[model samples]
Structure formats: C-alpha cells, structure tokens
Target: MNISIHSFTLKLRDPFRISYESRNEQEALVIQLSDTNQQGQTVTGLGESTANNYYQVSIERMQKEVALVRERIEEYSLANEVLNAGQVGTPGHLWQQLQPELQHSSFTLCAIDVAAHDLYGKKVGQPLYKLWGLNPADAPTTNYTLGIDSIEVMIRKMQAKPWPIYKIKLGTPEDLAIVRELRKHTNAVFRVDANCAWGVDETIENAQELKKLGVEFIEQPLKADNWDGMKEVYQHSALPLIADESCIVEDDVAKCAGHFHGINIKLTKCGGITPARRMIREAQRHNMKVMIGCMTESTIGISAIAHLSPLLNYVDMDGALLLAEDIATGVTITTDGVHFPDENGTGVQLLTPSPTSLV
Candidate 1:
C-alpha cells in the first residue's frame, strides 16, 4: 500500500464572500492511495480537502498534516503491518486507528477516509453510492450560491447562471434588501445563509422579511455556540434554521433538535463520507432535515460528497462549480441537480498527470 499527496490551487470564478471573510482563490490538497498487486496492476483512490482559513487549517497546515499521516503509513508498512486498506477493510477501522495519531483534524481524516472509500469502491467495481445501495433519484436539487456583493453585481452574477434553486450569502447591511432586489429577477426558490451575522432579535426580524421575499430557509443566523440565541430565533423566526458552524459531527446532530430545523454536513467537517453518512442518519433519527455543504473545493472533493447526495434532503455541494478551473472530472451540475459519471468508485478522474502515476 502507498499514499501520495498533491497540493493544488483553485481560482474562483468570482470573488467568494461569506459574512466573515472573502477570497478570490483557494488552495486545497488531494490525497491518492493505491496498492500494487502481483500482476503489477496499481489501483488508486483519490480524495481532496480545502485549506480553509475560516476553519483555521491553512493550506500549509493541511499539507503538513497529510505528510505526517503519510509518514506514519510508511512506518507501519516498514514493520510489515496490515493496515486497514491493505486488507480491503472498512474506513471506520482506519479512522479509529488514525484518529489518535491525527489529533482529530477532521479535514485530514476526511482526505484519507474519502481516498479509502474511493479505493474500496474501485476494488469492488462499484461506485460508493451503489456500494451503499443509494438511489440517485432521492437527491435534491443543489443550490447555486450568490455571494455577498453590491446589488448590481449580485444581480449580474445571478443573471449569469440559470438554476432552479439559489443559495444567497447574507450578513451584509443589505441582507434583506439584497434578497428583495434579486427576487425581482428570478422566481427561483431561495435559501439564505447568514454565516453567523445577526443577533437573536435581528435574526427573527430578518427571517420574517426574508420569508415574505420567498426565502425557504435561514442558515446559522447567530454565532455557532449561541445556543440560547439560536433557540430564541428558532422559536420566533418564520423560516427553518439550518445549522452550519454549529453542527460539526454526529454528536452535534441531536443537540440541533431544539435550536435548528436542519443540519448542514460538510465532508471535511465530519471527517469524510464515513462520519458524514453517520451524521446524516443521526440527524434523521432526530427528525431534522439534512443538508450536505462544501468548502470551495475541486471536483475531487465535491464528487466524493455527491456519492452521498442520494441520502440527503438538501445539497449545497457547488464548490467545484464555483471554481474558475478544476483539475479533475467528476460531478456535473444541471438545473435538476448534480449528475455523476458512469465510471466506477467515486466516478472521478484527475485531469492533470493522473493520481495513479503520481509516484
């Protein structure tokens, strides 16, 4: 077994902004794991992780963490030990073994977990979604994002694309105004994300106006840990609240029952598909809506998450769609939603030199 890490940079199609920060470009890491057989056949699995400064994991830091894990893999192999993937085992077991060593960096763990799933699926000659017996018809239409900008700019950006659902980024002084203006342009269903901008009272006030403007849901109205504030808004607001920063993993799913109507699961946030699936089930068990979101990543990451879209109620996995350039091929976005290729595993292929020959 062998693991290779490659760092890549992605430029955004437009300046991406949330409530707290903005960026023109993003740097991410791709991890590829493979094994050689007696016939010299090498099969590879690919995964990606975005180095989001908002998460306090910079590209440099993410690179270092992946290198550290790769070093550990080398050590284990030198001792002739059978690691989880070496024996066609589950990602959960590999996660448990690496959790202690990785210091619970969900981003790092996600890369490995996704790569393992990709490899396992390829070995079994099926995509991960098929392996899990998921139905693609169950997938909801993904929302195209309209980040915070001037009214004219926002309108222009919105007009540039055609989508059935649009997720608008709020947190500006003109939050409601932005929605009201955009509302005149398209009758498409809307989802608003505040990115932890408003106070409890303000959130409730904004929700009322947003509902009138035809918004479907409001995401992370207050600060992540502001449970009391969230509950206050949840009780008063007209719109359903979706937890973003507040819901990190499966453990946080049950806690969202009182404060939020739903939880947004990001692969990196929950440590890849293994825990992400668990998080989805946990959220459903608590009777809450489940959404799969993403950082601005490439097709490698978004494609990995797409495999699980069949199990989700909402999807915000347009990270790769927002990129100016993507070095891989995987999911395709349409008015209906994201569509995967017919290839096996995660159904993703790199456009560069290829992950299989990275060694």
Candidate 2:
C-alpha cells in the first residue's frame, strides 16, 4: 500500500468568528491510501482533517504527526504480511493497535481512519451509511452558522443564505442583542454557541435571555474545564446545554452526563467515524442527545461527517458549506438539509490535487 499526504489552506466564504478568534482561512491535511493489484487496478481512498489552533493542533504539528503515522503504518504493513490493504483488519483492531501512538493526535488519526473506511467501503461497493444500516430520513437538518459581527453585517450574512436553522456565535456584549435583532428579521430557529467564553452566572443570565428569544439551545458557554460552572448552569438554565470543547472524546461524554444535555461529536476531535460512532452510542446510552459537528473543512472532511448523519440528533456538519472554494464533490447542502450522492465509500471525489505541499 502507498500512503501520501497533501496539505492545503481552505479559504472561508466569510470570516468565521468564534468567541476565541476569527479567521478567513483554515489549514487542512488530506491523506490518501492506495494500492495496485496484479491486474493493475489501482484503488485509492481519501480522507481530510482541518488543523485547529484552538484545539491545540497546529498545521505544522499535524503535518509532523501525519508523517510519523504514515511511517508507522508502513512499518506495520511490512512486518505483518498477513495485513494486506484488502484485509487489513477490522476498524476496531486497526484503531486499537494505533491508539497508543495516535492517542494524542486525534485529528491526525481521523484522516487515516476516514481514508481506511473509504477504502473498505469502496472495496465492498457500498456507502458507509448504507453499510451501517442507517436510514436517510433519520438524518437531521443542518444549521448554517452566523459569526460575530456588527448588527448590520451579521444581519446581511443571515439574509444572504436564510437557512432554516442557524447557529449564532456569541460571547460578545451583543450576544443577546444579536439574537433579538435577527429574530426581528426572520422566524428561523436559532442555536447559540458561546465557544466557552462566559462564566456560570453569565451563562445563566444569557440562557434566560436566549430562552425568551426562543433560542433552541446554548453550546459550551463556560470554559472546557469548567465542570462546576457548566453543572451550575445546567441545573438552572431554561435551555439545554450542549457540550463542544467540553466533550472531546467518548470518555468525556460519560463525565459530562449530568452537566450537559447533549454532546457535540466532531470527527476531528474524536479521531474518526469508528470512535465517533462509539461516542454517539455512549451518549445515547447516557440518555443524552447527540450532535455531529465539524471544523471549517472542505467537502472531503465535511462529507465524511455527513455519512453518520442518520445517527445524529442535531447536525452541524456545515464546515464545507462555509468554504469559499472546495476541492471535492459528493454531498449537496440546501436550505432543507444535506443530501448524499449515490456513490460507494463516503460519496466524495477529489476534483483536483491540492496545489500546496508540506514544507
């Protein structure tokens, strides 16, 4: 098997603003796994992950980690002749073996894990959702995001797309004012994400104001490690709390059971579909709602998250929707929701090679 990595900077359609920062671009790494058979039939699988500075995974760090992971995979394939590209191992086995080395770099591991799943899905001639027996109707409607900006600017952004569901970024003094202002323009459902910027008392006050504005939920209002603060808000706030930075992996879900009403699972945060599926099940087992979210990625990464939409409660896999330019094709996003194409694997195809390379 041949493994290669490509790096690219995805330009955002608009400046994406969270409480922590704002950006017009994001860094991403694409991983491809390929092998040619005796008949000269070459099969290639692709996966991508965006590197987020907020998550502590920088572009340089992710690139270095990918190289290390690729070298390790090559060594394992050489040492174990039984593990071929076709019959490498179950997702569980593959992950268990690499967990120790890849544990700290979930974002990097996500790219490899997604690529492997793409390869296996293609070999089996089925999409991952179909393979997992998920129904298309069960997939939830996705929410388009509105970042922090002046009242006029933010309102203009909202009016441009006018998606049914909108995720509004908060944490500024105008957090409630933003919602109140948008409410005057449209009757769209709203979800607010504070990006872990408020204190417990402030979150309670904000939640009360948001609930009155008919905001659906509040996401990560307090800091990630502020368990006590989150619990305090969850105990009294009118809106349900959804964990983003607070819930990074499956284990985090267990710890966040009573503190948060729902958990936001991102492929970049949890590693890949394999672990993400596990996290969903775990969250469900704890009687918590599940949301599948994403970084500002391209079709390659966002499409990977879309495959698991059937298992999600609230879908925010609109990372690709925010891109000014996309290099892959597959899923289609509309005001209604996301629709997948009839293709094997993750239903994504790279239209062109990334022009950038790892320096």
Candidate 2, residue 51: how far the Cα is off, in Å:
1.5
Residue lDDT tens for model 1, 1-359: 58887877788999988899999998877888786433455777788888877789875676677766776554331111223332425566666667777756889889888887777677656777787889877888889999999999999998999788999999988888899999999999999999998898899888889899999999898999999898888889999999999999778899899999999998898888878888888888889999999898888888887889988889998888898988899878788767889876788888996333323
Looking at model 1, residue 344 earns an lDDT score of: 67
Question: Which candidate has the top score in TM-score?
Answer: 2
Over 4 Å off, model 2: 36-40, 75-88
Q: What TM-score would each prediction reach against the true structure? A: 0.93, 0.94
Q: State each model's CA lDDT, in order.
A: 0.82, 0.83
Q: Per-residue alpha-carbon lDDT of model 2 for 1-359, expressed as tens digits?
A: 57888888889999988888999998889888765433456666788888887778877787888776675665443111223332445444566667788899999889888887776666556777887888877789899999898888999999998888999998898787889999999888999999988899998888888898879999999999999888788999989999999999878999999999999998988998879988999999999999999888788888888889988889997888888988899888787677889986787888887787563
